[model samples]
Target: MYLGLDLGTSGLKAVLIDDDQQLLGEAMSALTVQRPHSGWSEQNPADWLVAAEEVMAALGVAHDLGAVQGIGLSGQMHGATLLDAAGDVLRPCMLWNDTRSHAEAAAMDADPKWRAISGNIVFPGFTAPKVEWVREHEPEIWSRIDKVLLPKDYLRYWLTGEAVSEMSDAAGTSWLDTGERDWSDALLAASGLSHEAMPRLVEGSHVSGHLRDDLAKRWGLKKGVIIAGGAGDNAAAAVGMGVVTPGQAFLSLGTSGVLFAASGAYQPDAPSAVHTFCHALPDTWHQMGVILACTDALNWYAQLVHSDAVTLTQGLGPLQAPSETLFLPYLGGERTPYNDAAARGAFLGLGHATNSSAGARAVLEGVSYAFADCHDALSSTGTQIGSLVAVGGGSKSAYWLELLATVLDMPIHVPEAGDFGGAFGAARLAQMAVTGGGASLATPPRTERTIAPRTDLQAAFAEGHARYKRSYHALKEAL
Candidate 1:
């Protein structure tokens, strides 16, 4: 057996997988996301460790630790976890969703040398800007920062007594050379940071260290159990869904939505529309387009109307076509195709008869349209994506899946596994590390369901997609 751990924003998720890739047990422990002010997001480092330890104990109750071989760590990407000389957390981790360093990001992007070396534009959500944010706003805290770690690496340090990061996570920091796959001294100097302040880099599946005896006892694992270096959450999810091969893609709808595809060589889009990152697969690369507020809009609507899923979705029939009402779907600003962080979501062409069900359906359609835009961007840059596999919280919604099919005018398939994305990828990596073999990661065994494009909806989405493209243009001045 092997264990996989995901240190997510709101919780620590762990899964136990046997040698055959079958799941034995799973556990989760929830944490908090502190928002002291607007546009700020933070989480306690110790909270993740506590949650991981609890989940491990709960999972151990069902599966014996004696069979466990290796462990893998995965977590939210681009979150900067600052640490001091004694390995104590200097402050709450600055998360990826937080947009507090726009000035720093813009300044970094202004330099032609950055794009020449890193092959990507700077973003406030990335690590280097967060470093700069701390350096300027919180000088006292910045002075105490002896080292910086991403979210997953912070948890792995507690488990294995080592502070190391995998390339996939490091690639999101805006300080690594995407082509050469290491820290770029020029970029680091530009950001006013030192190379020694960053953690050591390793491949995603490389074994970083063994479980310390005290932590092993606390988590009911054998002393010296190997821990593999894990990738960022999305990369790990792509691997778990078997989207690690070129031309294959995965769609995730959680707090955000993303369309991701693996690549053999580094491919960065001009103007930095899509983000290029190292894949969880060794020596492979991938690109992603993120929808800032995918299901999050739905969540907000649920709160506003005071209705549950059962109540809201009761009378909704299959959408015959895209509605005339179009949604911008940018409650939290956009990344790909439009790099504006201040962009806000909107609903255009709403009429008097638009009900709660119509609002829900439009939200789904808007996200799909955004994905179609992403597809266009990829095509312009020469990525050959054939199929898209849906995962995360939205994969269970048949209605949303059907909408994606109509919007993309292609079939959408779901993996047999439900929502254990990054955790499952971590387990698979652990299995590979334990066996020391180059086994191919299994594709999502078979399609749970396939949704084909609805002919009637084609024209409506085409018009709506055109207007969707224009919505960003109209909102640009306001942003």
Candidate 2:
């Protein structure tokens, strides 16, 4: 048996899989994000360790803990977990969604050397910008910083007593020369950090350390259980969904929306605000276009009107092709195609006739349009993605999946595994680390069904997509 742990923004998830790749059991522990300031997002690293330990205990109750051979980790990316010299957390981790570092990111982007060295722009959500923000705004905390760890690595440290990071997660930090798959001194210096402050880098599948005896005993597992250098949540999900080969991709509609495309070599589109990063596997790379919000946009709107997102959107069934109501799903600003952190969501073309159902439908269509824009940015890298395997919370909604399919004009497939997104992928990575190869597990993902594009909605959606693109610029100018 092997275990995959996902330290997500909202929770911690654990999945247990046997040597044959069958999932034995899975569990999750909820976490809360702290928003002391308007645009700042923070989480307690201690809370992550507690949640991780708790979930592993729960999962061990059903699975043969004695048989657990290895562990792999996946997590929300770009979070900066500052630690002191004695390895104590200095402050709450600045998460990937935090937009507090917009000024820092813009200042870094102004330097031509950054894009050339990192193969990507340093966005507000990335670790390097967050570091600069801390240096500038919280100098006291900066002075105590001895190490910079991404969220998953912090959890990994508790499990294995080693501070190490994998390539895929490190790629998002802006301190890495993504094309070279290693830390860039020039980039680190730009962020006012150094190589000594970063964790040692390893390939995602490589063994970074062994489970400490105390931790193993507490979890009812044997000592010497290897801990593999794991991946960022999206990269692990790609591995889980078998989107590894070039031209393969997946669209994730979780808290944020991600359009991920696999690339055989380094292919970057930093100028377009597309993320170019190392893949979970060695000698591989990926290009990602991100939307700061996806289903979360629906959740936000639903809450505004005192309804749940699923009931509000899914209840409307299949919305008509391009209703006049168009929304910009930038409630938390956008990443791909536009790196604007100040962008806000807006409902354009709404009139007296606009009701709750129309509002819900508009939200879904707006997100799909955002995905379409992201697709254009990713495709510009010359990777022709024929179809996308859909995952994340939105995959459960047939209406939303259809909307996405029609908007992308490509088939969207939902796997049989249901909502187990990053956790399942982490487990697959664990299996690979223990047994050399685990490709059989994800080759097909037990696809539940495929949603093909609605040719009938083609023209209407094309017009809506055009308007969706225009809405952002219009709103930006207005704001």
Candidate 3:
């Protein structure tokens, strides 16, 4: 048996799998994000631990955890979790969606060395700028910092009593030499950090450490069960779906929207705001165009109309022409093509005729348009994405999938319904860690069906997308 633990923004999920690679059992514990002020998002590290322990305990009640041979972890990337010399958390982790460090990010991004070495734009949510934010605003906390770990690595520290990070997670820190797959001294120095503040680096498929004896006994696991150096959430999802090679891609419509394409080599297009980060596997890289809001925008609109997302999406009869209404879906700023942290969402073309359904459809189309922007940005990098497998909570809506396919003019495959997410992918990594297998074990799940682009509406969507693009530039200042 093997175990996979995923620390997500909203919850922690634990999955158990037998040696044959079939899921035996799974459990989850709920979590909540704390936004104490505008433009900031945080989670208490203690909450993550509590949620993790709860899920593990629930799984233990039904499964034979003692037989587990390996463990793997996956989590949201770019969260800055500071630690003191005694290994105590200094504060709530600053999450990936937090944009309070925009000034620090902009100042660091102005230095060409950051892009030249890190192959990224040094966005406000990246770990380096968040650390810099603390330095400027909370110097006392900054001075006592002995190490900075990503969200998953902090969980790993508690599990194994060691601080280690893998490539996929570290690449987002703006302190990694992505091409060389190592920490960049120049970038670290520029961020007011050094190698000592960073954790030991490892490949995601390799064993980083063993579970601590006390925890192993408490959780009914065997002694010295290995822990794999797992991936950031997106990379882990790619691993789970077997999209590990060049030309393979996946579109994620979670709180944020992402278009991820695996690459055989390092290809940086920092100016385009396309993220070039390490893949979970060694000697591989990937490019991503991210939008800060997707389902988040839908949920916001749902609340505004006093209706749930499912009800709003279900009420729509059929896919119609693009609504006169246009939404910017930039509720919490944006990332790809325009790294504007002050950007906000807006609905253009609203009139007396506009109703709740039209607004909901506009929200969906706006997110699709944001993805179209992502597709174009990735295209500018000469990345060839033949098709994209759709994943995440928003993909549950057939209407949204069809609309997204039509907007992108690409086929979107939906895998047979199951838990092919970060936790499952982490389990695959655990299998690799124990068995010494690689991509062969990470096969793509069976495709239940494919959503092909609607050729009839291509021209209309093309025009709508053009207008959507124009609206951003015209109203960015006002919005």
Candidate 4:
């Protein structure tokens, strides 16, 4: 048996997979995200460690822990976890959702070398800016920084006494040479930091370290269980969906939404809203579109407009024909296609006659419209995506999936076992590590279902999408 874990923003999930890729046991522990100030999101790194321990205990009771010979880890990307000289956490991890470094991000985005190396425009969510935020704001903590690690790499340090990160996760830090697969010396020098302050980079299939003997004993596992270098959550999800091939893409909607596609070469979109990162698969790359709000927009609308509604699932049944209302899903600043940090959400063309259901449906359409914008941007860059695979919490809603298909005018395939996506991808990597095979073991299992586009709704959606784009452009000047 092997263990695969995803250290997500809201929870820690551990899955036990046998050699045949069959799941034996699964466990998850919920966590809280703290917001001490506006546009700031933080989490305690120690909380993730505790969650891992709790889940491991649960897995120990369910399955024979001694049989678990390997471990793999996937995590929320771009979070900053700083450590002190003796390896103590310096402060709460500033998370990917945190937006406190907009000014620094702007400066970094303007630097020609940053663009030349990382192949990305800067954002507050990326690690380098967050590190600068700490240096400028909390000088005392910044002065004590001995090592800076991504969220998952920090967890691995606690588990295995080794500090390392894989290329896929490292690429999001805005301090990596995506093309050459190494630390960007130019970026490091500009940021007033050294490459020695970062963890060593390793391939996703390489053994990052062995489990610490004491911790391994505590969990009733073998002392030398090897931990495979894992990936960022989205990359792992891409691998889990079989997006390792260049032409395949996946659409995921959890708290945020992502559109990811694999590529053989580093292909970046001009104007640079989409991120080009090294893929978990060796010698490959992937591009992703990140929107800060997706399904969460629907949940927020459901709560505010329809508080009396019993369950969110009840809102999914067939309703009246689509309404004239349009929504802009910029509740938490969009990423892909629109890198506006100050942008706010809006409900256009609303009338007193509009019902709660209309508002709810508008939120769904708004997210789908964002997905459409991503597709358009990729197409403009000469990417030929044949299908978009849908997964994550939002994919379970038929109404949401149908809206995405209509808005994009393309089929959406739902891959099998998507709920365990990150974990499954991690397990697959560990499988390759144990067997020493690369791409031959990276393909995901078959998809479960496909939602074809409705030709009848295409024209209507095209008009809505055009209007949505126009609204965004008009609102940009005022924002």
Q: Write the per-residue lDDT of candidate 2 for residues 1-479, one digit (tens) a residue.
A: 88889998889998887766677888999999888977778999999988987897898777779888989999999999999999999988999989999999999999998899788988999999999999999999999999999999999988888899999999999889888889999888877778999999998878888899998888899989988888999999998887888888899989899999888899787888889899998899988999988878988898999999878865786657787888888776679888888887888998999999898999889899989988898777676896688888888899888888888889988888544478877877777777776545447476789999899988889998988887778778888
Which number leads on TM-score? 3
Give candidate 2 regions above 4 Å deviation: 418-420, 437-442
Task: Select the stronger candidate by TM-score from 1 and 2.
Answer: 2
* lDDT per residue as tens, model 4, 1-479: 87889998879999888887777889999988898987788999999999998999999887889988788889999999999989999999999878889888988888778878998878788999999999999999999998999999999999888779999999999999999989988899888888889899988887888999999889999879989898999988776666788788888888789988888898766375888999886798998878888876877787786563235546657633456888999886778887777777999899988788777778888888898888877777777887688888888887788778888888888777645478777877777776675434545557788887777878888888888899899888776
The whole-model lDDT of each prediction reads 0.81, 0.87, 0.92, 0.84
Off by over 4 Å in 3: none
**Alpha carbon lDDT of residue 325, candidate 4?**
87
Q: What is the lDDT ranking, best to worst?
A: 3, 2, 4, 1
**TM-scores for candidates 1 onward, in order:** 0.96, 0.97, 0.98, 0.96
lDDT of 4 at 344: 76
Candidate 3, 43-86: lDDT as tens digits: 99999999988998999899878899999999999999999999
Over 1-479, each residue of candidate 1 has an lDDT whose tens digit, in order, gives: 88889887768899888777778889999988887876688998888877977897898788788778899888899999999989999988988877788788888888887777777778778888898999999999999988889999988887776788988899889988888888999988886678888888888877888888987786677777988887889988876777787898888887777888888888887474788888876779998887667776677666767876545544467765767677788776677788777777888778998878787777778888888888777777789888888887776777777778787777888767544588888888877776775645855647767778788878887888888887779767665
Clashing pairs in 1: none
User: What's the number of clashes in each of the models?
Assistant: 0, 0, 0, 0
In candidate 2, which residue pairs get closer than 3 Å at backbone N, Cα or C atoms, i.e. clash?
none
